[model samples]
Target: MTVREDVHSAGIPVLCQSCEARHRGVCGALDPDQLVALAKTSSKHRVEPGIELIGDAETVDSYSNVLSGVVKLTKSLSDGRQQIVGLQFAPDFLGRPFKVESAINAEAATAVSLCSFPKAAIERLMKESPELEHRLLKQTLNELDEARDWMLTLGRKTAAEKVTSFLLMIARNIDPTVNPTAKSATFDLPLTRADIADFLGLTIETVSRQLTRLRMDGVIRIENNRHLTIDSLSRLERRSGA
Candidate 1:
């Protein structure tokens, strides 16, 4: 159990000083004293790509905040079919609050770093700080909106529109400060052709064909098959039907 007196007096630990998500994530809602208390029980984890952070239907013992890289949330059928439900990036929270089990599997899509806290400890903090709870609630709502938007992209958009929408989603979400009318933007793709196909509900051949079309149309430039450069945000958005 965390004693309040000890936290206010002891100050934050060395481990928290360099946390990349400190000011941008849920921790930003906490005061220094609360952070000290939270850090006392928190642990850092570095995961490799393809490692499952939480298995579907497994008991939830903890929650985490992504410090870097990407995580893919997926649902699987008993027959081994699976679908990518969502993607979590740095500064995003993981695990469901007040829930005993996970509904989906969370796998590291890239080399990932996280700060983990026991569920009990985090719940205790939430009780004491409504701000923290509000922060989490806000994140949940934003994710909900994104999920709804993605549903439309998957169900309504054409193949070319889907590819464009995917790229625009990556650009817009990867950096919140991405200029809406910038002449160009550059970023590396977190998912491969297979993963992209799975997420977009398309075949790998279709994904490849669309990507090649995007390149041929001069909307985007590709190098090394992963790094992509968009020449015009407006043009991309037009192509994306956004």
Candidate 2:
């Protein structure tokens, strides 16, 4: 039987049985009994776009798994300027472990669903579950790698390449189950053009120009200023200079 089948047959919590986080996220490291223990203190909730899930320097009381939608992570300067630093998708674990406070602002980039557990519960489980700690460590390393790659995007890539790279990143991450060779993808822009500009280090007009250029070149299709469809993922990747 498949691992999922095993998990289900083992009678894990019904809510966890169907969660992407449980199957593909940190929770995947857990056994059925551990899941049951974690679920006893977990809660699922949804937040609308623009809601702050964690504030900069705020006390860290809980951690969450992104069940759906995107989360925008940003850092703010003392002078009140903020920059979009990272984006998290479903199945991505939220919160930095072993930290007393958040270093960045975590806001719902779109309508988001989260399964959250108290910091104490997760930390306790980490001490008891080596696999859980491994999963978290792996995810943290992956994020570091991604952040480095993004530094290349911001510091070296041209305006057009940055925009294309941004779109490709979203298309690739928006759905974890999307086949790597899938030719097409459809999704709404989780961030507005202004936000995209901030993330990509470009002016809003430049971002718009690149999107229009991509559309004119038949690389992607846009609707109502938000919905986007990439007819050819390979083509988009090429445009991204990847």
Clashes of 1: 0
Scored against the true structure, residue 228 in model 1 reaches a CA lDDT of 96
**Each candidate's TM vs. the true structure?**
0.89, 0.94
How many clashes show up per model? Answer: 0, 0
Give the worst 10-residue stretch by lDDT in candidate 2: 1-10
Write candidate 2's Cα lDDT for 29-130 as tens digits.
998788888887887778889899999999999999998899999999999999999999989999999999999999999988888889999999999999
How many residue-pair clashes does candidate 2 contain? 0
Model 1 earns a TM-score of 0.89
Model 1 root mean square deviation, Cα atoms: 4.6
Q: Any idea what lDDT model 1 has?
A: 0.85
